[model samples]
Target: MEHIYLLALVGGGLIGLSATLLLYTLGRIAGICGITFSLFMPQITDKKWRITFILGLVSGAFLIHLLTPIAIPAAPTDNIYLLIIAGLLVGFGTQLGNGCTSGHGICGIARKSPRSIIATITFMAIGFITVFVLRHIWGVI
Candidate 1:
Protein backbone atom coordinates (compact mmCIF):
# COMPACT_ATOMS: atom_id res chain seq x y z
CA MET A 1 0.00 0.00 0.00
CA GLU A 2 2.79 2.42 0.82
CA HIS A 3 4.60 1.38 -2.32
CA ILE A 4 1.52 2.17 -4.41
CA TYR A 5 1.37 5.66 -2.95
CA LEU A 6 5.06 6.21 -3.58
CA LEU A 7 4.74 5.04 -7.17
CA ALA A 8 1.77 7.32 -7.70
CA LEU A 9 3.70 10.26 -6.29
CA VAL A 10 6.66 9.60 -8.55
CA GLY A 11 4.39 9.15 -11.58
CA GLY A 12 2.57 12.40 -10.81
CA GLY A 13 5.82 14.28 -10.37
CA LEU A 14 7.11 13.00 -13.70
CA ILE A 15 3.89 14.10 -15.38
CA GLY A 16 4.21 17.57 -13.89
CA LEU A 17 7.85 17.80 -14.90
CA SER A 18 7.07 16.75 -18.47
CA ALA A 19 4.24 19.24 -18.72
CA THR A 20 6.44 22.03 -17.41
CA LEU A 21 9.23 21.13 -19.77
CA LEU A 22 6.87 21.11 -22.75
CA LEU A 23 5.37 24.45 -21.83
CA TYR A 24 8.76 26.04 -21.24
CA THR A 25 10.43 24.64 -24.35
CA LEU A 26 7.59 24.62 -26.91
CA GLY A 27 5.23 27.26 -25.55
CA ARG A 28 2.51 24.60 -25.82
CA ILE A 29 0.45 22.73 -23.26
CA ALA A 30 1.24 19.03 -23.06
CA GLY A 31 -2.29 18.08 -24.05
CA ILE A 32 -2.48 14.60 -25.57
CA CYS A 33 -5.64 15.36 -27.55
CA GLY A 34 -4.11 18.49 -29.04
CA ILE A 35 -0.90 16.62 -29.83
CA THR A 36 -2.85 13.79 -31.50
CA PHE A 37 -5.02 16.19 -33.47
CA SER A 38 -1.91 17.88 -34.78
CA LEU A 39 -0.83 14.59 -36.34
CA PHE A 40 -3.74 14.56 -38.81
CA MET A 41 -3.10 18.12 -39.88
CA PRO A 42 -0.64 18.18 -42.77
CA GLN A 43 -0.25 21.92 -42.45
CA ILE A 44 1.04 21.70 -38.87
CA THR A 45 4.75 22.44 -39.09
CA ASP A 46 5.81 20.84 -35.77
CA LYS A 47 4.61 17.29 -36.18
CA LYS A 48 8.00 15.82 -35.42
CA TRP A 49 7.93 16.67 -31.74
CA ARG A 50 4.34 15.52 -31.46
CA ILE A 51 5.25 12.16 -32.99
CA THR A 52 8.22 11.84 -30.69
CA PHE A 53 6.12 12.68 -27.65
CA ILE A 54 3.51 10.07 -28.59
CA LEU A 55 6.17 7.48 -29.33
CA GLY A 56 7.77 8.20 -25.99
CA LEU A 57 4.44 7.66 -24.26
CA VAL A 58 3.93 4.26 -25.91
CA SER A 59 7.53 3.13 -25.56
CA GLY A 60 7.68 4.31 -21.99
CA ALA A 61 4.70 2.17 -21.07
CA PHE A 62 6.25 -0.84 -22.78
CA LEU A 63 9.57 -0.20 -21.10
CA ILE A 64 7.91 0.08 -17.72
CA HIS A 65 6.01 -3.15 -18.25
CA LEU A 66 9.24 -4.89 -19.21
CA LEU A 67 11.37 -3.42 -16.47
CA THR A 68 8.93 -3.31 -13.55
CA PRO A 69 7.08 -6.05 -11.72
CA ILE A 70 3.81 -4.19 -11.99
CA ALA A 71 1.21 -6.01 -14.05
CA ILE A 72 -0.71 -3.75 -16.35
CA PRO A 73 -4.38 -4.56 -16.43
CA ALA A 74 -6.21 -5.45 -19.58
CA ALA A 75 -9.24 -3.63 -20.89
CA PRO A 76 -12.33 -4.11 -18.78
CA THR A 77 -14.49 -5.00 -21.72
CA ASP A 78 -13.61 -7.28 -24.61
CA ASN A 79 -16.65 -6.41 -26.70
CA ILE A 80 -15.52 -4.59 -29.84
CA TYR A 81 -18.75 -2.63 -30.12
CA LEU A 82 -18.51 -1.49 -26.55
CA LEU A 83 -14.92 -0.51 -27.03
CA ILE A 84 -15.75 1.45 -30.18
CA ILE A 85 -18.62 3.27 -28.52
CA ALA A 86 -16.51 4.08 -25.49
CA GLY A 87 -13.71 5.40 -27.67
CA LEU A 88 -16.14 7.56 -29.62
CA LEU A 89 -17.68 8.91 -26.46
CA VAL A 90 -14.27 9.72 -24.98
CA GLY A 91 -13.22 11.47 -28.19
CA PHE A 92 -16.45 13.41 -28.21
CA GLY A 93 -16.05 14.36 -24.57
CA THR A 94 -12.50 15.53 -25.16
CA GLN A 95 -13.72 17.63 -28.09
CA LEU A 96 -16.56 19.11 -26.06
CA GLY A 97 -14.32 19.81 -23.07
CA ASN A 98 -11.53 21.15 -25.33
CA GLY A 99 -9.09 18.85 -23.54
CA CYS A 100 -8.67 15.49 -21.79
CA THR A 101 -8.13 14.88 -18.07
CA SER A 102 -4.36 15.11 -18.20
CA GLY A 103 -4.62 18.43 -20.00
CA HIS A 104 -7.30 19.91 -17.77
CA GLY A 105 -6.42 18.23 -14.48
CA ILE A 106 -2.66 18.59 -14.72
CA CYS A 107 -1.34 21.23 -17.11
CA GLY A 108 -4.41 23.46 -17.20
CA ILE A 109 -4.91 23.44 -13.44
CA ALA A 110 -1.20 24.05 -12.93
CA ARG A 111 -1.51 27.13 -15.14
CA LYS A 112 -4.61 28.26 -13.17
CA SER A 113 -6.91 28.15 -16.17
CA PRO A 114 -10.52 28.55 -15.04
CA ARG A 115 -11.87 26.61 -18.01
CA SER A 116 -9.63 23.69 -17.25
CA ILE A 117 -10.61 23.68 -13.60
CA ILE A 118 -14.29 23.67 -14.43
CA ALA A 119 -13.80 21.04 -17.10
CA THR A 120 -11.94 18.81 -14.68
CA ILE A 121 -14.64 19.17 -12.02
CA THR A 122 -17.39 18.46 -14.46
CA PHE A 123 -15.76 15.36 -15.89
CA MET A 124 -14.80 14.04 -12.48
CA ALA A 125 -18.34 14.48 -11.20
CA ILE A 126 -19.76 12.82 -14.26
CA GLY A 127 -17.26 10.00 -13.98
CA PHE A 128 -18.20 9.39 -10.38
CA ILE A 129 -21.89 9.37 -11.23
CA THR A 130 -21.21 7.06 -14.14
CA VAL A 131 -19.32 4.54 -12.04
CA PHE A 132 -21.96 4.62 -9.34
CA VAL A 133 -24.72 4.08 -11.86
CA LEU A 134 -22.86 1.36 -13.68
CA ARG A 135 -21.58 -0.56 -10.68
CA HIS A 136 -24.42 -0.19 -8.24
CA ILE A 137 -27.58 0.70 -10.08
CA TRP A 138 -27.01 -1.29 -13.26
CA GLY A 139 -24.77 -3.94 -11.68
CA VAL A 140 -22.28 -3.49 -14.50
CA ILE A 141 -18.57 -2.86 -14.43
Candidate 2:
Protein backbone atom coordinates (compact mmCIF):
# COMPACT_ATOMS: atom_id res chain seq x y z
CA MET A 1 0.00 0.00 0.00
CA GLU A 2 2.75 2.40 0.96
CA HIS A 3 4.66 1.45 -2.15
CA ILE A 4 1.63 2.24 -4.27
CA TYR A 5 1.31 5.66 -2.73
CA LEU A 6 5.01 6.34 -3.26
CA LEU A 7 4.78 5.31 -6.88
CA ALA A 8 1.71 7.50 -7.37
CA LEU A 9 3.53 10.50 -5.98
CA VAL A 10 6.59 9.83 -8.11
CA GLY A 11 4.47 9.36 -11.20
CA GLY A 12 2.56 12.60 -10.59
CA GLY A 13 5.79 14.48 -10.02
CA LEU A 14 7.21 13.14 -13.26
CA ILE A 15 4.06 14.21 -15.12
CA GLY A 16 4.22 17.73 -13.74
CA LEU A 17 7.92 17.93 -14.42
CA SER A 18 7.49 16.80 -18.00
CA ALA A 19 4.69 19.31 -18.59
CA THR A 20 6.80 22.12 -17.17
CA LEU A 21 9.80 21.12 -19.20
CA LEU A 22 7.80 21.03 -22.43
CA LEU A 23 6.26 24.42 -21.77
CA TYR A 24 9.67 25.88 -21.07
CA THR A 25 11.47 24.28 -23.98
CA LEU A 26 8.87 24.09 -26.71
CA GLY A 27 6.44 26.80 -25.65
CA ARG A 28 3.70 24.23 -26.02
CA ILE A 29 1.46 22.01 -23.93
CA ALA A 30 2.38 18.35 -23.48
CA GLY A 31 -0.88 17.03 -24.83
CA ILE A 32 -0.56 13.49 -26.14
CA CYS A 33 -3.58 13.78 -28.44
CA GLY A 34 -2.29 16.98 -30.01
CA ILE A 35 1.21 15.61 -30.37
CA THR A 36 -0.05 12.39 -31.89
CA PHE A 37 -2.47 14.06 -34.31
CA SER A 38 0.35 16.23 -35.57
CA LEU A 39 1.99 13.19 -37.13
CA PHE A 40 -0.88 12.60 -39.54
CA MET A 41 -0.83 16.11 -41.01
CA PRO A 42 1.89 16.66 -43.58
CA GLN A 43 1.85 20.44 -43.30
CA ILE A 44 2.70 20.62 -39.62
CA THR A 45 6.24 21.84 -38.89
CA ASP A 46 8.72 20.36 -36.36
CA LYS A 47 7.50 16.80 -36.54
CA LYS A 48 10.59 15.33 -34.93
CA TRP A 49 9.91 16.61 -31.41
CA ARG A 50 6.32 15.40 -31.52
CA ILE A 51 7.42 11.97 -32.71
CA THR A 52 10.11 11.79 -30.03
CA PHE A 53 7.69 12.86 -27.33
CA ILE A 54 5.21 10.14 -28.34
CA LEU A 55 7.99 7.57 -28.58
CA GLY A 56 9.16 8.51 -25.11
CA LEU A 57 5.65 7.80 -23.82
CA VAL A 58 5.66 4.35 -25.41
CA SER A 59 9.18 3.66 -24.13
CA GLY A 60 8.20 4.69 -20.62
CA ALA A 61 5.24 2.31 -20.65
CA PHE A 62 7.50 -0.53 -21.77
CA LEU A 63 10.01 0.33 -19.05
CA ILE A 64 7.29 0.28 -16.40
CA HIS A 65 6.03 -3.08 -17.65
CA LEU A 66 9.57 -4.43 -17.45
CA LEU A 67 10.32 -2.98 -14.01
CA THR A 68 7.30 -3.01 -11.68
CA PRO A 69 4.12 -3.84 -13.50
CA ILE A 70 0.76 -3.47 -11.83
CA ALA A 71 -1.45 -6.47 -12.35
CA ILE A 72 -3.94 -5.49 -15.03
CA PRO A 73 -6.53 -8.07 -15.86
CA ALA A 74 -6.99 -9.05 -19.47
CA ALA A 75 -9.62 -6.99 -21.22
CA PRO A 76 -13.11 -8.44 -20.95
CA THR A 77 -14.09 -8.06 -24.57
CA ASP A 78 -12.70 -9.66 -27.75
CA ASN A 79 -15.12 -8.11 -30.22
CA ILE A 80 -13.45 -6.13 -32.98
CA TYR A 81 -16.54 -4.02 -33.73
CA LEU A 82 -16.88 -2.92 -30.13
CA LEU A 83 -13.22 -1.96 -30.03
CA ILE A 84 -13.53 0.05 -33.22
CA ILE A 85 -16.61 1.90 -31.99
CA ALA A 86 -14.88 2.72 -28.70
CA GLY A 87 -11.82 4.00 -30.55
CA LEU A 88 -13.92 6.21 -32.80
CA LEU A 89 -15.87 7.56 -29.85
CA VAL A 90 -12.65 8.37 -28.03
CA GLY A 91 -11.22 10.14 -31.08
CA PHE A 92 -14.37 12.20 -31.50
CA GLY A 93 -14.47 13.10 -27.81
CA THR A 94 -10.84 14.16 -27.90
CA GLN A 95 -11.55 16.47 -30.77
CA LEU A 96 -14.66 17.85 -29.13
CA GLY A 97 -12.84 18.54 -25.89
CA ASN A 98 -9.94 20.07 -27.83
CA GLY A 99 -7.65 17.80 -25.81
CA CYS A 100 -7.56 14.61 -23.77
CA THR A 101 -7.21 14.12 -20.02
CA SER A 102 -3.46 14.55 -20.01
CA GLY A 103 -3.75 17.86 -21.78
CA HIS A 104 -6.58 19.18 -19.65
CA GLY A 105 -5.99 17.48 -16.30
CA ILE A 106 -2.22 17.61 -16.11
CA CYS A 107 -0.82 20.39 -18.28
CA GLY A 108 -3.86 22.63 -18.60
CA ILE A 109 -4.93 22.54 -14.97
CA ALA A 110 -1.38 23.02 -13.75
CA ARG A 111 -1.08 26.20 -15.75
CA LYS A 112 -4.38 27.40 -14.19
CA SER A 113 -6.41 27.57 -17.37
CA PRO A 114 -10.14 27.92 -16.71
CA ARG A 115 -11.06 26.01 -19.84
CA SER A 116 -8.88 23.11 -18.78
CA ILE A 117 -10.47 23.09 -15.34
CA ILE A 118 -13.94 22.81 -16.83
CA ALA A 119 -12.90 20.19 -19.33
CA THR A 120 -11.20 18.08 -16.70
CA ILE A 121 -14.23 18.30 -14.46
CA THR A 122 -16.47 17.27 -17.32
CA PHE A 123 -14.19 14.34 -18.12
CA MET A 124 -14.23 13.15 -14.52
CA ALA A 125 -17.95 13.46 -14.19
CA ILE A 126 -18.64 11.67 -17.46
CA GLY A 127 -16.17 8.92 -16.61
CA PHE A 128 -17.79 8.34 -13.25
CA ILE A 129 -21.24 8.17 -14.78
CA THR A 130 -20.09 5.79 -17.50
CA VAL A 131 -18.50 3.43 -15.02
CA PHE A 132 -21.58 3.50 -12.83
CA VAL A 133 -23.88 2.76 -15.73
CA LEU A 134 -21.69 0.00 -17.12
CA ARG A 135 -20.91 -1.73 -13.83
CA HIS A 136 -24.06 -1.29 -11.80
CA ILE A 137 -26.86 -0.70 -14.24
CA TRP A 138 -25.72 -2.71 -17.22
CA GLY A 139 -23.83 -5.32 -15.14
CA VAL A 140 -21.02 -5.24 -17.66
CA ILE A 141 -17.93 -4.76 -15.57
Off by over 4 Å in 2: 68-76
Clashes of 1: 0
What does candidate 2's lDDT look like per residue over 16-109, in tens digits?
8898899999898998888888788889989999989988998987787778756644776887886787789878888778899889988888
- Over 12-101, each residue of candidate 1 has an lDDT whose tens digit, in order, gives 899889899988998889999889977987899889999999999999888888999978878588878867887999988897778997
For TM-score, the strongest prediction is: 1
Shift in Å, residue 26, candidate 1: 1.6
RMSD of 1: 1.5
Candidate 1: worst 10 consecutive residues by lDDT? 73-82
Relative to the true structure, how large is the alpha-carbon lDDT of every model? Answer: 0.89, 0.86
